[model samples]
Target chain A: MTATAFQFDDVTFAYRTQRALEGVSLTIRSGERVALLGANGSGKSTLLRMMDALCFPASGTATAFAAPLTEAAFQDDATNYAFRRRVGLVFQNPDVQLFNPTVSDELAFGPLQLGWEKPKVRDAVDTVSARFGIAHLKDRPPHRLSGGEKKRVALASVLITEPDVLLLDEPTAALDPASRANLVGFLAREPGAGRTVVTATHDLDIVEDIADRAIVLAEGRVVADGPVLAVLHDVDLLRRTHLVFEHRHSHGGPPAGSHGHMHSSRQEG
Target chain B: MADQRYGICGCGRGRRGALDSLVLGLVNAEAYALDAEATATRPGFLQSVDPRIKVLALVALIVATTATRSLVVLAALFVAAVALALISRIGPGRLARQVWVGVLIFSGIIVLPAIFLVPGTPIVHLPVVGWAITLQGLRSAAFVVGRAETAATLALLIVLTTPWPHVLKALASLGVPAAAVAVLGMTYRYVFVLIEAARHMMEARRSRIVAPLDGRERRRMLMTAIGMLLAKTFALGSDVHAAMIARGYRGEVRLLHDFHTRPPDWVFLAIALAVPALILGLQP
Candidate 1:
């Protein structure tokens, strides 16, 4: 039996007056590839934050590896360090994640923070930079990198710690077509074996390639959770959540009158 | 015509406005940072030295330049600065544009009155104003300008050759608090982000302009834009902190300290120190 990586039971969270998540209950097993699908402001990011223990649920309970994710639980240095070593979260914005002065430093930050040895940190930084094909950019500042390079560096920085479970938010947003394709292909390869990867994104076109299970969110509530293909083929659920739009177009041939078709809003390149 | 005469309305004027100047200044600041990074990464004499030694040696030279009162010694230091720039692959034109011209003009205006106000042997006289240019005043003006120019050149050389983070780390090695160095690094990293944000706001406003804004309207628009930028900065700050925490930043920053000093680094440091010491020793 697979171990449970994350468990959220009746979790609800709010930001002052506005609620960001409501009654979100789900369980993700170790080694499972899952996608959190939602439109903007649908609480996918907030959920990822909760799972990473950066934020606590305002109600109910959230657990990671069967340990409760609470501020009090993290107060113990040993527990916090252990949790951080086993999980990594890559933020939606590369600027937010790549805060170090140089790419090499950024890649070494997590391990150094976890109290890794100096020599080990250096080796890990070099290995991760090379793995991501960012060896040439090791000394470059984050602001000087192009968008795709920044994304690669951000991912490398998180993966340097060799976390067991990786969480990514909008991983392919704002990428050029070729860069997007490159990223999708990489994620599809599942860089680490048996590594639980939960990605939060609204990009439906790449969903099938990145995940085996999909969870859809709307208005801070989970509307559906099922196999990736089943969830994707549910056109009504997709349209209701604003993940896809009704395409009305006419062809120039037989049966070419204008008709409404429901499909991925993203144009195939 | 009346509105134009009142300076509240105008057309067909191609002069740059305050908004344009602000945008240009922001863009130039970003470009200057990128240029410094490019120069720092170039294979040059100063770029190869360890940052800690480089910081100490350059600071010593600057101190030596400031302490010397003799014009000959100051001139020697200035000439040495030019030579160092040449060896470091920093072009003379870059020094002229980025340092020399601005320092000369601003410092010249400041010391101009000294040429006539000081009591000494008269060198020249202004016919209309009947003010005498004293020999002692000329010497004083030269001293002030020479010291300013030399010290600025040495400082600019440090900035042009060493990456900003390396400079901050070197400061940490020199007894600066780790928290202070971290703050400085974060501020340097985020300043470019804020500049880009401000440029976008200004570009958006410019796109909507149908006519020239009056002084009052321009002030109002600028104030509003500043407020929006401040709000965005605060939000970004919160998000960045959360991201930092997720990656296990536990209130203390730990960076990769990868600086290694070799034999050549030590040799270069000896030369850097000896030249400044030699200048000070030659001071009469």
Candidate 2:
């Protein structure tokens, strides 16, 4: 195995008296785009949170970047910062991540936190903002933007960090059609050679656009893992869970029509 | 039935805390009262005025009002401020309601009873607490209460008239300091964000459990909201700081490149300064 990006063994977590996660084991490899499917309260976000180190599993060990995140994961600032450098988190609510008055500021947030020099921070902001086609939104306050604009800004903020592992919670929950398409398209835009993406969402339309791998979690435990296309189209598998949309592909070569399906529920750009 | 906080919206009075949260909210988005049936309110002349001039005028007015205590002069000042406030086109009904809720509550806590407790020209004395009444005390209370209301009205009028961003631009030009502006800037940026988070929390809560809560969930929801909001604000603030850094935000705050003072703005500034200077110099 080419060095597992994450290794979790029978992990459990609780918030005071309420248990948020229970015995779960999974290994995520680099260059894998995994879509985590489940309804709200299915502990999908909780598992993702643990992976982001936003929360720690109560029982069992979980490891990322060769460091065990169980007991004393957040001890040193340098280590924690480095861990964050490798892992980036995007929240479901666009407003939560966008705290800057202007678009460019929102984009520069993470890089500045990591203390990138002024020039690098500016470059990152410009590159990400432009990629989202939001260069004109540079000086605008985040409050006044349309929902789609806000989402783009939020994503730009995370992309500026240049993390190896991306953790997203409901990435396209409130975006408009074009915004959603732009977002999915960007997510599909090939990540770096060793980058990994893990997103918690029930929206399957995005699976074809992004996921190369899949992880279906129910009640905080893994149910299945396989290729994105194979795991997503398994009628029996989707029936047991809320994930139902299937991605349909058009054929360009011989025998391609044999696998063509009805439709992909992608929100049109 | 248990009452809920109605968020400064009078209609939601039965829903929640019955307080006038409208002032901080007027230019803010969180408490944005979306009336699909309601028409967008037109900007009054004061609202349409250049933000920079309004800031200077309001600041000058507040300073002058704070520096005076003569009841006759202050009463006249209050009257002038009220007339000017009316010109902003806020309906009489709304203005009256705001004054009663805003100033009365604010003044009562500090100075309302002082008028009777203390004696100034012995205009009036309390039936009870008459022993505390003194001319100087009465005068002092009147000074603060009257001036404060006048100044506050002027301040509120400025905010209600001009949009928040324009005000920030104006303050930046006048050298009001970047640190203070950042506080307002962050609030404008984050209040809606926090509110949005609260809405999601409410939505998530609604989607799951049928009844109110098991107390654990309720507590969790509240804690989660607080934690998430705190995390959100800190994250945003850091991002904003970074955004500034990326855009070459040094310690010193600067005006937006598009913002510039025109000839009329300077003339307006001149008039504002002249009036205040004339009033201050003319006074004893």
Candidate 3:
């Protein structure tokens, strides 16, 4: 069996006064491209953060690469650095990640932090800048980029680190239609061999194209774990989990892909 | 690399001014990052020069110009400054528009009692206040104004030429402590993101303004807006942090080198430094 990439055995968490996660037992294997499907406040993002070792679970076991998830796992700066490089996380909004004056610096930030030499850093910056089609944007201020461009820049920033696993939170939110299509196509086709990618998204259509499998979460526990075509459209289960949207008419068809977005039934269409 | 790339920068003063700004700011060794950029007239110039040299040069010039009370020397330094700015391709008008705060330094000492203090002959009487304008007073005022104008011009020229990165890069190259460069680099990257976030925060609040509030509620409304902005800023900070982590940053900074000093750079440096060094060396 593939070694566990990320696993939590009865993990639980609380945010100040509210309980966020409880008894969430799951094992995600290496190279598993799973889409994290959940309603708002279902502890999806918190779970992704735990995998990256950003926030610790209040109780129970969360492990990555067979190492028990603990403060000691990140006690050494090198360890924390390696952890960050190993599991990258992209936010929904580009405003959170891109803080540089130009595209090159923003892309280079990660590699230099990884302690690569100057020449290597520069090369990496250039490569990723081109990869995201921002090479011309090398000198442009990141904030001025269009919504799609900013998103691409943000992704390039993380990919420069060449992470082993990618955790994306709402990888597409607030993007225009063409850009969204571009992002979908890119994510679906990019290199992820031997690397795990778990994306938390509200747009079920993305889950159809990019992800091979799905993990459904609602109210902090996993409800369904199966292929993307099956779990996403399970309307009765989603409604039971409080995740069925007012727009979803039925499930069980060509998946909840973009074409079926507010229309409800994909079978009818 | 592209010649026409800077046209879209929107500084509106043509390319020469922009390039001068990119270069001079580096010479003056201005503090960098978005904060400096926000208050700064130009940052791209300073980004190319070695930070330590720029810092030292700025400090040295400021001292040489400000230490004395001689109109003739002050006038010479001011002329030299304008000449440098012109050579750098920064417009005189751009310099004028750039340094409003700098003029206040001369104004602060405008009413000084140099005439009363100096053991020299009085020159002319004032028309309005009937105050005696002594030779010493005129000399001192000229010195102060000239000194400030020269100093301001030099600094402003530096700012116009340098970008924030080059200043920091120069600092790091010049043996600024590692932690300092690391912090500065990180913050500079974040500032652009923060500004973008700020725009969103403001818009989010603005969207809720279906109807305008009365005069008395304006303060409270602004306070709420500020509070919301701060809260969103923090949230964005965390999200950005996560995004950076995803990008695979490990807290290292490596600045790209835009210049390897040509013989011309040395000649320029020699001329630039020689004038000030000679002034200080051959002081009366």
Candidate 4:
């Protein structure tokens, strides 16, 4: 069996009077690409935040790399730094995540915080900016950029740190079709060595291309866990979990006189 | 449209005017952002100078201007600032709009009362108020306005020439407190976002208005929006802080502000610093 990269054993958490997650026990193996599929407020984002140790569980233990995840564990600056360096979280909103004025500074922020020398930090920023195709936006303010450009800068800001575990919350939300395709293609091609990519998203079309395994959450509980194709193809399960709505529609058939016809069917509204 | 009694005017027209002014506010905010970008991108002398040197040189000039009580010296500094602004491709019109309107006019108003209030030799008697203006008072008022104008021009020049990031980085390098610098950077970046968000909220509210709101009703709606915005801001602040912490940012904000000073930068700094000293030295 693959070594467990993250283990959440009966972890429960609440926000004020609302319970966000309940008995969320899950074990993710190293280098596993997991898709956290759920409806809004289904605790997908909360789960990812827990994995990054940004939030603590009210009950049970959340462990990453065999170390217990807790506020006390991160009380030590070095331990917190190491944990942060290993796990990078790309926020859903680029506006909040991108606090730096310029794109270059945004990317260099993490490396600089890690105490890398000036030259090394500059090189890392340059390399990452180039890879993200934001070399032209190096001096441009992040807030002034277009939505897609801002998203790229936000992702580059996190990826420049070269974290081992990449946790993204709704990574494709608010992106144009082309930018969305570009991001999906990038994630599919460059999962990177020894890095685990867990994306919380409702965009099921790219799940097959980006994630191998799927974890479906419904009302703060794991509804299903299986291969991406199996979970996504099971329309009944998807509808029951509220990951996808039951739409009654069909493309009817292929072009006239074609060799084969095409059609799709599902539950009624 | 209902007749809304505004604080300024008691009529429905006042409500319409308020809506128009709200739109204008967004335009004004955008224009400031545009000016900052335009001045930084302009091809000019100060645009190419190193920001660290630029900051220190301009600050030195301000200090020199404030220390010298000589009108002649202050006038010379003001002229020098205007000349620098012209050479830096920042239009005289733009400078007039920003510095003259923003600083000089306000300073002039404040100093106007001083001319009549201060005890000095009578120069000219005002026709309306029947108050004699004193030479000592006039000189003192001119000195105050001149010093403020020169300092404001030089400060605006630095901001107009240098990109905001470099300016903040220079401040950080020049021994500004780390926490203070961090706040400065965050404010510079997020303040615009907040403004844009508020603008959008206003636009949405305006669009949804089926009928004009009375003064009290408008105030209530505005209060609700403001309260919601504040609540959102608090939540967003926490989220942003969390995002920063998740990326290994532990209080100290370290940035890679790379600056290379050519020989010209030193020459410019020397000239900039010397002019102020020369002006002060030639003072009586």
Candidate 5:
């Protein structure tokens, strides 16, 4: 078997008095595009953050790249830097991820933090920004860009770092249809080599294009883990996990073809 | 999407009543957007210079403009600032409008009362009881207004000519604490985000309004909107901090390029610094 990129050994975590994750154990192999499918507050985001070493497991062990992640590991400067450089986590809200004034600066932020020299940082930023189609927004401030543009910049900022693993939290939460399709197309493109992509989203429509594998979470527990098509096609399981609900599309048209299916529903805690 | 239950707008008659504030908000938004975009796009005199030099030189000029007590020097500095604005291709009209609205008129209003209050030879008698414009008071008021105009013009010139990121980078390189610069950068970035969020909240409220609100009712709703916006800002701030940390920000903010001073930068710096000194030295 391929080396595990991320291995969670029965991890459990909580915030204040509430439990966020409980006895969640899973293994992600290298180069695998895996989707953490779950409703809101289902611990998908917390799990992704743990893999990036942004948060440590409360009880069990979470390991990345063969090393067990720990509070002490992140306390060490070299280890913390290396861990952060290796794994990138994109926040759900573009406003939170994009804190730089201009798109160029936002894309340049991570590489510069990694202590890349001026020319290298600039080159990386240019390449990634161009790839993400944000070259026109180079000097534009993040706050001024439309929602789609900001999301593109946010993703570009993380991708510019050239991390080995990418952890995306609800990457398409607040996007319009055009932007959503654009992102799906970008994510579907194969990056030449070994790069693991783990997306924490319950967006079923994107699963087939973005990821081959699906790990479904419900109420802080893994209810299903299998191929994307098999898991998402299981309407009963999806309904039981509260990932989709029955909705009648009565306003748009007279019974349209294939429009009879239920739409995905995002649960709120 | 909320249904448009009214004609010509998402809100009915309520939209007309809110038109004044809406127009004001749009103007402020456009002003900020134009200020950020116009300077960065134009290839002009000040835009080419190093941001560090521009910031330092303009700041020095502001200080000198305020320090000199001579009305001639202040007027000379104001004239010089206008000349530079023309050369820099920053719309002279725009700069004048900003200074007139933000500084000149404000100073004019504040100094108006002083013109009648200070004791001196009465130049003109007003229709008001026991009030006359004094020559000394007028001269002193002119001094106050002139100083203010000069200082404000120079400050606005700097902001209007330089990109905000470059300006922040220059500040950071100039020994401003990294943490403070980071905070300033975040605040600058998110201020617009907060404004946009607040606007969305207001729009949502407007969509839900079934009837026109009286002034008191509108004020209460505005207070609630402000409270919610503050709460959202707090939560957003934490999330942004976490995202920063995840991306390897360890207190110190690192940028792609360091400030490099070219020969032109130095020459520009020299002229900028020398103008104020010459004005001060040549004072009669």
Candidate 6:
């Protein structure tokens, strides 16, 4: 039986006066690749935060690996450490995530926090730096790096710990075309294999490559949940959720077979 | 569109607009960071030494420079500082801009009055005021100026040779509180982010200026920009805390301990300590 990695039951979260997530419930299995698709402010990031135990549900239950994800649950150091080791979250903004002074330190931060030995931390830093092609940037401060480099360092920092579940918030939001392709290609490759990957993004073009399952959110609610192709083919749901829209386009060769195609809401020409 | 002439209202001749200042500040910060990184990574004498020993030794030298009353020792120490900078690939022009010229001008102005005020053997008389320039005042001014320049040069060497993270780590290793070191490190890391945000804000403001902004309007605009920046900084801070927590920070900050002291580092430390001791011993 596949182990359930995360289970949310009617989870509702609010930020002071605004409702960020409402009655959002989903179950993600271990080793399954999933994409949380939504427009901006559609509760995608809030849900990922809850899963990572950074925040708690206001009125409902959320669990990771069958453990209750509450503030009190995380109060226990042992449980918190174990959970943090098992799950890693890469923030949407690389600047926020890359807070350490240097790329090497940032990569080693997680292992050190988890009480890994000094030698082990050093080895992990070296391995991950080389794997991410950031060995040249080990001594460089985070602020000195470019956007793509920062993003790579941020992801490599989290992946250094080899977490079982990886949570990425808008992993490709601000990347350039080549960088976006590089990141998407990397996500499609071996690092994500056998890890329960939950990526929250609004980009549709890379969804098929990064995820097998797609969970769509609209106005803080799960509007669609199915296989990747099924979700992509649901034009009505996609349009309603503001992920994509029907646009008229004609090929230069002929206008006889011209048909309206779905263009991503965030698509840039 | 408003007339370009009128658009330059508060930013007239001899006046610097806030937007220009913001852009200039950003550029200066970028240059400083690049220069520091370039110098720190260069293969040089001090750059090869361990950060902890370098920090301790330079600090000892600065303290010795301050405590010594001997003009000969102060001048020697200042010369030694310049020699170290030269060996460490720091050019004379860079040293002048980074330390010497500014310190000399500022300290000169401060000590100018002392030349007329201090009681000692009269050396020269001012043509207009007829105030005597005493020998004691000249000696006092040299001591003050030399101490300031030497101390600043030593401090700058530390900054220019070692990477900032290594320096902070060395501080932690030397019994500085981990929380304080962590705060300093985080501040250093995030200042660049804040500067970039501020630069973008200033650029957006500059792009939208179709009409002339008077002094009052410019002040209001500046105030509004500051308020917005504060709000954004608060939000960024909250998000950064969340990121930290997500990464298992768990309140007590932990950093990687990877510093190793070599035999050369020890030798450098010995020489650094010996020079200070020798200078102090030669005092009087």
Q: lDDT winner among the candidates? A: 6
Provide DockQ values for all models, in the order shown.
0.72, 0.14, 0.41, 0.76, 0.74, 0.82
Ordering by DockQ: 6, 4, 5, 1, 3, 2
Model 6 chain A: worst 10 consecutive residues (lDDT sum): A260-269
Q: Cα deviation in Å at residue A172, candidate 6?
A: 1.2
If you assessed candidate 2 against the hidden native complex, which CAPRI class would it receive?
A: incorrect
lDDT-based ranking: 6, 1, 4, 5, 3, 2
Clash totals for all models, in order?
A: 0, 14, 46, 0, 0, 0
Kindly list the per-residue Cα lDDT of model 6 for residues B1-284, writing each as its tens digit: 11232232353543557855775666677679778978898999999988999999999889889988989889989998999899999988998998899999998899888878999999999899899999999999999999999999999999999988999999989989988998999988888888878777876776787766799988898889889989999999999999888888888888876778999889888887887787678776
DockQ agreement of candidate 2 with the native complex: 0.14
Q: Model 2, range B41-68, lDDT digits (tens) per residue?
A: 2445555456777788777777767765
DockQ of 3: 0.41
Which one wins by TM-score: 4 or 6?
6
- The alpha-carbon lDDT assigned to residue B151 of candidate 6 equals 96
Worst 10 residues of 2 chain A by lDDT: A260-269
lDDT of 5 by residue, A65-153 (tens): 88889998878888888888889988989989999878888888888887888898888877987788889999888877888998888
Off by over 4 Å in 1: A252-256, A265-269, B1-15, B115-136, B275-284
**Worst lDDT 10-window in candidate 5 chain A:** A260-269
Tens digits of per-residue lDDT for model 3 on A77-178? 777776776878777667767766567777777777677787888888878877888899887667558999998988888888788888888887788879
Interface root-mean-square deviation, each candidate:
0.9, 7.5, 3.4, 1.0, 1.1, 0.8
Candidate ordering by TM-score (highest first):
6, 4, 1, 5, 3, 2
Candidate 2 residue spans exceeding 4 A from truth? A1-3, A15-20, A99-105, A117-123, A138-143, A190-194, A245-269, B1-64, B70-145, B157-284
Error of 5 at A236 (Å): 1.9
- What would the per-residue lDDT of candidate 5 be over residues B208-258, giving only the tens digit for each residue? 877667888877876777678779999998888889888998878886545
**Which candidate achieves the best TM-score against the true structure?**
6
- Scored by CA lDDT, what does every candidate get? 0.87, 0.67, 0.68, 0.84, 0.82, 0.88
| Evaluation by TM-score, superior candidate among 1 and 5 | 1
TM-score of 6: 0.93
- Candidate 5, superposed: residue stretches over 4 Å from native: A245-269, B1-27, B90-92, B113-134, B214-219, B258-264, B279-284
